[model samples]
Target: MKIATYNVNGVNGRLPVLLRWLDESAPDVVCLQELKAPQDKFPEEAIRNAGYNAIWHGQKSWNGVAILARGTDTEIKEVRRELPGDETDEHSRYLEAVVNGVLIGCLYLPNGNPAPGPKFDYKLSWFERLITHAAKLYTLDIPVVLTGDYNVMPTEQDVYKPERWLDDALFRPETRAAFQKLVAQGWTDALRKLYPDETIYTFWDYFRNAYGRNAGLRIDHFLLNPKLVGRLTTAGVDRHVRGWEKTSDHAPVWIQLKEK
Candidate 1:
């Protein structure tokens, strides 16, 4: 099965680009982030017409997440819609579902800018919550794919110019360490696992002709638990999608699993 993740930035604004990619790529399962729309505003019918069923967690003009399964025959049994350990935290940032026997967790982690502030602190707190929850998922002994826009460059290789982003929240030492802690729980970074030394990137800013200059960041990721690691056959980024008109800053990233 082909599973993919993309941060669409705004589902409504980027509908055309998304549909085009869906038609072209035809991934069996997709996890979308940054819908930036309220629950009532999600374009359910449009998505259905494109041959996919979706369950989404949306918020007003901000964070949101969704999981899509192609075709009516595909089962998308929802497990949860929010990360555990935070009752008052209302961000629509995490969504989980069981698709074709694999537990898929889609998330849009906080973009904690202006480090050393409330937002940054919230980012770290959120990371801790994620870490706690991920550890539990690790022990489930079922095939699991935790994929999304993590919003952090886990290593210097993930950022175009690592030194310039060291002070930034996404690349700060604390953020990277948190990501490493999560990975240390025996989750494999799918893309990195496939191309251990390649400079792969999944996101590029609109400013300063970043995309043209290839100044990109590999923030979006797919983490496969031990049970699913052997099935990881191939993975890649659809970088051309990022150049589409009115497209999202993030390109679609995907991994194909060999059928057992």
Candidate 2:
């Protein structure tokens, strides 16, 4: 089955581009981030018409996450809406579901810009929570896929110019270390595993002709638990999608798995 993740930026404003991608890519399972809409504002009917059954956690004009399963035969069930370890945290950034027997975790990690501030502190705190929760998921011994816009460049290879972004929140030493801690829990970075030497990027900023210059960052990622790693067949980014008119800065990233 083909599984994909995309940060739509704003589900409403980019509805057309999203619909077109859904039709063209036809992934069996899709994890969406940055809906930038309230729960009630989600375009359920439009998504339904596009042949997907979805469950979403939305926030007002900010972070949001969703999981979509294509077709009727897929058994989709919501398992969790928020990450454990934080009751006070109300960000609609994490959502989990079981899609055709595989556990899928879709998340939109905090941007945490302007480091050494409260927002950066919150980003680290959130990372800690995710790391703790991910450990629990690791022990489940089931096929699991944790995919989304991670918002961090895990390594220098993930960024267009490592030196330029060294102090940026997304490429900071603390941020990268946190990501490594999560992956050290025995989750495989699918894209990196498949193409270790290649410079792959999933997001490109709108300014400075970033997309045109191919100046991008591989912040969006797919992590597979031990049980799911063996099933990984292929992975890639739909880079062209980022160039579409009124499209998101992020392109779609995907992985295909062998049938059970």
Candidate 3:
């Protein structure tokens, strides 16, 4: 089965681009982030017309997440609208489901740019909650695939100009350490595990013509639990999609798994 993740930026504005990618890629399951729409404005009819069943958590104009399963409705195992420490409903960042018996989660982690403030603090606290939740899943002994725009550059190699991002929250020592802690708990960075030396990137900035110059970062990822690592047959970034007209800053990152 093929599982992919794409941050469409806005569901309504990028509907055409999304439909085109779906037709071409045909992933069995797709996790989406940054819908930037309300629940009522999700364009459910259009998505269903494209041959997929979707469950989405949407907000007005900021963060949102969704999962789309082709050919059938996915079994939603859980929807974590609020993180454990998040008392205020700040963002629609996480959603999880079970498709074809594989546990999948879609996330849009906080940007936390302008660090050393409340937002940055929230980001770290959010990571802590995510680690707690991930620990619970690790104990389940099931194949879990977590995919999305992590807003994190795991290492120096994952970014094109590492120096530019060193002071940024995404690549800060604290951020990378938090991400490493999660990986140490037994999650495999799917694409990196497959092509360790290849600079496969899934996101490029619209400013400075980053996509044209191939100045990008592999922040979007698909991290699989150890139980799912053995099933990972192939994983890659579909960078061509970023060249499409009115495309998102992010391209699709996908993985194919061996049949059970």
Candidate 4:
């Protein structure tokens, strides 16, 4: 089965481009982030007409996530409205489902810029909860895939201008350490493991015409559980999608796996 993760930026604004990509790519499963639309505003009928069954957790104009599975209604195992210990109900960052018996999670991690502040603290706290949840998932002994715009460049090589991001939240030592802890818990960073030496990327900044310059970052990813590692056959960025008119800053990252 082929699974793809895309940060659509905004569902309404990018509907045309998204529909076109869906038709062309034909991925069996898709996890979308940054819908930027309210729950009532989601175009459920349109997505269903396109042969996808979707379950979305939406909020107004900022953060949202959804899972779309071709020809079948997704079995949403959980809708994490609140990260543990987070009383503010701040962001709609995570949603998880079971598709074809594989536990999948889609997340839109906070872009906690201006570090050494409340936002950065929230990012770290959120990561801590993710670690706790992931540890429990590991105990379940089921195939799992976590995919999304992680908002963190796991390594210097994953970004085009590494030095530029050295001081940014995405590349900070603490952030990387948090991400590394998750990987150490037996989740495989699929793209990195598959093409270790390749400088492939999935997101580009709109300013500076980053896409035109091929300046991008591989912040979007699919982290698979150990059980699914050997089944990973193809992993890549659909960079062409970034060139579409009115496209999202991030491109789709996809993986093809051997049948379960």
Q: Which residue runs does candidate 3 get wrong by more than 4 Å?
A: 73-80
lDDT of candidate 3 over 1-260, digit per residue (tens): 99999999998999999999999999999999999999889988988888899888998776999999997565555645555655775688898878888888788888887897888887788888888888887877678987898889999889998998888999999989999998889889998889999887889999998998999998898888878999999988889999999999999889999998
Query: What is the per-residue lDDT of model 1 for residues 209-254, given as tens digits with 9 covering 90 to 100?
Result: 9999999999999999999999999999999999999999999999
For candidate 3, give the lDDT of residue 253: 86
Per-residue C-alpha lDDT of model 2 across residues 146-258, encoded as one tens digit per residue: 99999999988888878999879999899999999999999999999999999999999999999999999999999999999999999999999999999999999999999
Per-residue lDDT of model 4, residues 129-243, tens digit only: 8888888777777788888988989998899979988878899999999999989998899998889999998999999989999999889988898878888998888899999
Q: Against the true structure, what is each candidate's TM-score?
A: 0.99, 0.98, 0.96, 0.96
In model 1, the runs with Cα more than 4 Å from the true position are none
Clash count for each candidate, listed in order shown: 0, 0, 0, 0
Error of 2 at 33 (Å): 0.4
lDDT of 2 at 88: 99
Model 3 accuracy (lDDT, Cα): 0.87
Candidate 4 similarity to native, TM-score: 0.96
The pairs that clash in candidate 1 are none
Model 3, residue 24: distance off in Å is 0.4
